[model samples]
Target: MLPSPLAAAAPPLPPQSSDEDFFSTASTSTSSDSKPRSPPPTLPQIPIVWPEAGALTASWVADLMQAFEWASKALPPSEFPSVLPVAVFDKLVLTASKILHKEPNCVRIDENSELNSDCRVVVVGDVHGQLHDVLFLLRDAGFPADDRFFVFNGDYVDRGAWGLEVFLLLLAWKVLMPHRVFLLRGNHESKYCTSVYGFEKEVLVKYGDNGKHVYRKCLGCFEGLPLASIIAGQVYTAHGGLFRGTIITPSKRSKKKNRKVVHNPKVDSLILGSFEELAKARRSVLDPPWEGQNLIPGDILWSDPSMTPGLSPNIERGIGLLYGPDCTEEFLKKFNLKLIIRSHEGPDARDKRPDLGGMNVGYTIDHIVESGKLITLFSAPDYPQFQATEERYKNKGAYIVLEPPNFDTPMFHSFEAVTPRPKVNPYYDFEDVIDSDEELDLVSMVTDSGLQQPAV
Candidate 1:
């Protein structure tokens, strides 16, 4: 059952758009039918394209740069991080929440919210709280709202030491460029995950134990973030991949029966009624009580796409359902979307075959499911947490600068791990606990179901 936080303050039902009529139809393929593409080349470790390139190209960048410097220096060469004054932290989080509140729970980016077809918008994946990589990413993208539009596909916190610095930088960008910059909810952002993964302790370290208040405030912001974003009316971007949950379908029995469908307007423009129960749920209050993994929220934040043909329960992850090509086709067709871009997994720089989604192409995990539509772009180069060592993190981090007119395929600019910090000490006894990351079943369903050549 989903958590009901708004028993007395129940939000009004969401509006249904006339365009939802497109959800049930098959969308035309925007994928390339061209020959196999060459793998993207590697980039410099510290690709400093910022201050040296002249002033940053955007307005909000200067402020973000200032905050970035403060955050970077705040951490002495020690393990413990400096604290943010409760008032200062409160102002920061509250400001971010206020901006996020303007977006729907299930946000629909209208034409005005999107850039032209031939615009280079940067798309990035999991940063797992690595602050330096984020700075590198900003330098690589030339900073948000500058010459390019940016979409951070989630996992902004957890696993690394500087999650606070990284997340605040993104929030600053969002507050500054509400339209030009977008942030999606990630698996790690949820309170349940943070308490387990590392973000909670990071907060406690940075702001003191009493700073659980800041943690709660962080949850408030996470709750407000959109689940997915549509770019240029063609791309469907989210932190995790597809979700197969309580399917809320409008009755086919009679058009009149579904005409007055009631959904939470605080949720989305699409009237998804009971589905709102799941979407609007206070996921921080799930099973396992105050700790441990729960089901519903787990899938949205944790699920992965399988190359298999049908549905399968992902017992390994213990929560999310593993989806296949048919599921991908249905989701894209349901939303009339051409591309499904997710970042829960990275690409494999070593693997040249795009169909074989693995840890080779920067662990990208791209599949030719229902055509060349779904691509995973992991952005934290030389990941600096858990057991993500220099060797394992070799798959250079990347951002897709997408444009149209001729924007049929995205161009990936990948950079090698930049002056990465050492891995965080394991919080658990590996001898006692089985490493979930090692046990992850991602890419287990690798096979060529008439694999199509990637446009990359």
Candidate 2:
């Protein structure tokens, strides 16, 4: 249950629906005229559970899982009911927004981030819309139990056909176990990116205006999400790799002697802003100064790491800074941290490289052995890109089960993509799919696929 203050501010609940109601045809909530209607008569209940405080019972979660699986299997995922209905999503947006408002622009966390000697945490990265995989992680991996705590490293939406399913399910679980789940912002969780990516378009096509509204509200929640998390106060976690608050040096020598390259040294590279400072870095930040803007709102959301010696512009991505092992080491020492756990890049491959995966891999650790510093965690395995037809060994994904933060040994779980995902079209380009209605779909296709630290 939420604290008294937060509970008091909760949004009004819509009238209850039966077990069969969610999958039933949606009501005309999207009548161009925005008229408020009276509440529906309360039903006895579905097999689903909606206990007090929005806390879900185990039965409810199981039902929700079955609901999503049934929906995806019933029709082509790109169709109308492939995703959650308009009214349901609309209610969810409101609830999610209220919860987000309770959180500060930058959330502060000190206690929960710390893992006791016996406690273990599961750090996840970049599910990227693999709904079946997420189900596997929860059911197969056994998450969301009262005892387990989770720190999701973002990149939750986009790239997969089931992005909405993945996101809403995670959000539902967050509401279920608010204190045990932690969500960090990823590079993809913004307006500009989602607009270009398939998330925005998918909603518009599936749920229409209500979906658009829910997408907007989701962005608001994204804006309010914390940029970085301090784990056990010893590890710093974020989506992108690293950042510097300010420039300290002006120039640097290149590989050739006397050949100077332009380099702006950071004043304090390792010091992530306190919760108050992080809270201020919100949705407004789109690109970095190097790309266009002078002030990037959250560096942790955009930055990447390099193999060289110091911090440098990430010309390849056209934004954010790239740090080398030396740079990572300095940042860790500067902040008095032992490790920097990050996502943003894929674990098996550099950029979701198809056919570049293998078994027994879920995360990549860099700088830890050489510099006692960074570990990169990419949770999406066998990232099935639309054009990826080639068969390869590197199609497995991985995650880390951290044991009490005692010298950073995490148990690894790796698996390949399950069957039942769309085969012809990539997730980002789903909107472009034209009629070949007779065309064989993944239906015949056969593809497959949260903790909290602080609010205010």
Candidate 3:
């Protein structure tokens, strides 16, 4: 059976106290329809605050101040940059504002579904819409129609100019084999990133207003995606790392009993819904106030892969955040899992360094590390165009294959395989090269069978 939807819903709180109201009295005033009302008077623009010398060069400072001034005068108050405190450096504020504009604070993933017993799995790294590379990897890995299940591990769009095409192909494949194929939400799947990075605008450019239809379809796919999955009772796979306040417990009752859980109360209420419920809970904890201390185990869905081991000292006490290995052992002991397979980190990470020697593999962009207890994989072989370098491998592209456990052999088979390329050099004509009648006949026999004859 396909996974079910999460039961969490926005709560209907009692009427708010007067101070808590979001709608102001001014906003409620309705002008008479008989005559159109005049536009409201513009407020005085705030002067640009310049940074002190040594902090920012005069030219750089002037340019930013000019830009801010221009924006203040041209844009509406709601669109203006928030005023920074005098004590904060103007240059810092300007830099931060630019970063914020590029990378939105919040990301949204729509939803997705998958069959329950499709246990054997292989998750591809980020595709970034590299059509040839994606197809090559799938073909080489024996995917799409293989008995083994597959997860795209988020990042199906953006970076590559071909996000739409890539997503459409995946959508078609999903329809063909809904039970075996799954797409999970990635940080790049957000509206903020899509708006700036080209996926959203690309669709608009390609489909016009109908572009929104495409966007909605993609968002729906994202929203319905399972945040993470446990396969063959041993692995947990998602786009990113675990959130700060998350704790993994054996039972749903324990998750509820934990007082530190501060995500949407609705999510806590729906703990028993399905694996998708765990995903919704992850979204809430990883939202705004991300730096806030109350994260829970479900929050791991949104956490970024970190090189640092052990609990972050900056994190609050009493919250049960554990290393990937600790998490692996705990899950193994409690749920009878033999290992933990995760894909947030790259498959080629420097050393198999999970805090507790857990198997981990990092297989995509940046680095890929494959350890015994934890493994990181990436489906997008190329680095995102907007970001750093692409992943390096002897093979043209990559994917993983998992088999049932055996006492004589390890539980999983994970590695990169090199693909031979066609020879580019011209063949040589040598007088002594198999000129005998028997040898010539043998060459002719090989060529007749569609095999390449030895170069002469």
Top TM-score model: 2
Q: Write the per-residue lDDT of candidate 2 for residues 1-456, one digit (tens) a residue.
A: 111222222233456354343222222111132122222222212223344565554455545665665565455544544345555555555666566557643343445534466455667888887776676565334454444567788888876667777877777776666666777778778664566457787666566646667677677767655566666666677888675443234346544455432223333443333333344444444322231112234357666666666666554454456677887777677667777788777632354333222222656666653436677777666564443445533445666666554635556666555543433244465446421111212121122101121110
Question: Which residues of candidate 1, in runs, are more than 4 Å off?
Answer: 1-74, 77-84, 245-297, 346-356, 363-365, 369-371, 384-386, 390-393, 406-408, 420-456
For 120-220, candidate 1 gives per-residue lDDT tens digits of: 57788888777766765565455554335778888898766778768876876776667767888887676555665677777766666555877788888
Better of 2 and 3 by lDDT: 2
Write down the TM-score for model 1. 0.68
* Global Cα lDDT for candidate 1: 0.55
lDDT of 3 by residue, 287-345 (tens): 21222222333244333333454333212111223243443343345544443334433
Worst 10 residues of 1 by lDDT: 36-45
Candidates, ranked, TM-score = 2, 1, 3
Worst 10 residues of 2 by lDDT: 447-456
Candidate models: Cα lDDT each? 0.55, 0.55, 0.39
Clashes of each: 23, 30, 50
